[model samples]
Target chain A: MQIIIDPYSWLLGLAGGLLIGLSAALLLIGSGRIAGISGIAGNLLFERGPDRGWRALFVLGLILAPLIVGWLRPELRAAAPTVNAGMIVVAGLLVGFGTRLGSGCTSGHGICGISRLSPRSLLATATFMAAGFVTVYLIRHLPGLA
Target chain B: MKNLIGLLAGLLFGAGLTIGGMVQPQKVLGFLDLAGVWDPSLAFVMGGGLLVAFPAFALARRRDRPLFDLAFQIPTRNDIDKRLIVGAVLFGVGWGIAGYCPGPAIAALSALHPATLLFCVAMVAGMWLQRRLMR
Candidate 1:
């Protein structure tokens, strides 16, 4: 098995991760909220209350960040999708539904929850990660799938 | 004040994903494809995030309350229920298939890619579906 190592990508990922951590920290310090994208977005749609304002604004900021960055640094922007529309849709639905059912996603559970040393989050992260590894193995390595 | 902080946090989070290449489907897929030629960039992203967030959360434990709120609104649930396992597995399958999780998918909307738009729309619909099912 050959491993592909890219120092540039790793550095960029670390830098970006720092930014993500900083954002989470800021949200916690300032608003006493976890920076869980799934929770924020899901609640923004389903919940009706004073909480909507912050959720909406947070999503707006998320949407706007890439736009602003794309404008200024087009090369550094995210790439387009490689998968077909059908797969994207199906995956999106599953992610949305599953995250809500589980009460968290990578951000909520993997980042924030783990940081807080929550047992549930640790188990959830492990479960999802194992599931991901197995799923990818099936999709890519199985005889008929790939 | 809280709303403003939320916005800033979102912005930073999005930027992090984009800069880290986590917003790219291929990169995520590469990380997941452990049997194949594995890319370990995602690990660094998580590591870097945890390095900072761990300390911040520790500090938070010492504080009585946040700056803009009466109290911290952290989750306190600790049950290892069926829903958690089932939901995570399903989410993992979807993530493996499309290489887009909630955060990156939402941030990728700026690209205005048809697949991303469709994914986001479907994801919201899925969220709505879950709420309906729960009700």
Candidate 2:
């Protein structure tokens, strides 16, 4: 499939960031939750209360929205990338572990944390960006990986 | 009122993933491969995100309470401990290897991408394991 650069994509990207920021903001305003993926995911694991329903719903909406959009606009559907199952699993485990240790994921730290201008968040975001940079460098340059 | 805002926010976020071309793992992989044919598009996406978010955040901070509620709950801990560094490394490794971070991974699920499903399952498992270890 030929990849075409759609200028509309930029508008969508900007809109998406606004939505994420808005969601984080609203979650804080309404539910008093941080919309932090790790924290929300963690609550689903450790807590079995009524709050779980909203978290579940939020996640469900996240999963369902793309499908609904794709169904409406067939052009939106793109080929899935080729990656081994083992790699996928390892990657997931690593992210989960990182979230717990970091006390938040990208949404929490990069979005909500940074928004609030918390010193911890600043450190966390820097760490997050730096780590991403290193990983990309290693994967692309290292032999037998790319 | 809050739920409505949350829903709208989510819709926008979903649209952003679609438009940012972030839904495509290959695009992300390209950005990751700095030594090779690196695509600087993701940087633009990030920049665009910051462009929209930075001002909104600044404005929001000035308000004593959020539009619908009381004070913002900010995490107070500032210590750069072992957990912080190790977790970040792990996250980077995952992102580098899989080309999907948590937010985008969830977004990818809507596309019914197989790799995304596998990644999500593994992520959940990792979360469980961390809880166990922490306990």
Q: Return the top candidate by lDDT.
A: 1
Off by more than 4 A, model 2:
A1-12, A29-32, A72-75, A78-81, B1-4, B67-71
Candidate 2: how many backbone clashes?
0
TM-score of 2: 0.84
Q: Which lDDT values do the candidates have, in the order given? A: 0.89, 0.69
Give the C-alpha lDDT of model 1: 0.89
True contacts kept of each: 0.80, 0.46
Chain A TM-score of each candidate structure, as shown? 0.94, 0.83
Q: Judging by TM-score against the true structure, name the best candidate.
A: 1
Model 2 Cα lDDT, one tens digit per residue, B1-135? 554554555555555555566667787777666666766666666656555555666666566667664566556687778787778778877877777777678777766667778888898888889888978
Docking quality (DockQ) of candidate 1 = 0.83
Query: How do the residues B76-95 of candidate 1 rate in per-residue lDDT, one tens digit apiece?
Result: 99889998998899889889
Best by DockQ: 1
lDDT of 1 by residue, A28-138 (tens): 988889988889999898789988998998898898898877777777677656878888888999999889888889999999999999999999899888888888889
